[model samples]
Target: MVSDRNMLANILRTELQIHKSSFILGSHSLICIFIYSSFIHQHGGRFHLSPLREL
Candidate 1:
């Protein structure tokens, strides 16, 4: 039979994991993927940026 302490520990661990996942993929990473796909695809026929611009 499992003790109450062990059951509580398991529940707490699972809750911690769920909370930790919230910030795994912030907006910055998502924007990077979007920009890369838009700027570097279609044989370079996508959005045209001035030389002074940088992502």
Candidate 2:
């Protein structure tokens, strides 16, 4: 179960990084990214999504 959660987190992080540049180009995309980051922060803990902090 823990591994599955970590896998999901990894996938999410990868996807976020892949699209992050494009996201910064649009206002709506910024909102979506903020929501995604907040959701991850709440559910996955800061450690799991620490890479996003650099963005």
Best by TM-score: 1
Span of 10 residues, lowest total lDDT, candidate 2: 46-55
lDDT score, candidate 1: 0.69
lDDT by residue for model 2 (1-55), tens: 9999999999999999879966667878788788777766876665454555755
- Enumerate residue pairs that collide in model 1: none
Per-residue lDDT of model 1, residues 1-55, tens digit only:
5788899999999998877775565666887777667666743765655422754
Candidate number of the best lDDT = 2
What is candidate 1's CA lDDT for residue 30? 83
Q: What lDDT would each prediction earn against the true structure?
A: 0.69, 0.76
Q: What RMSD does each model have against the real structure?
A: 5.8, 18.1
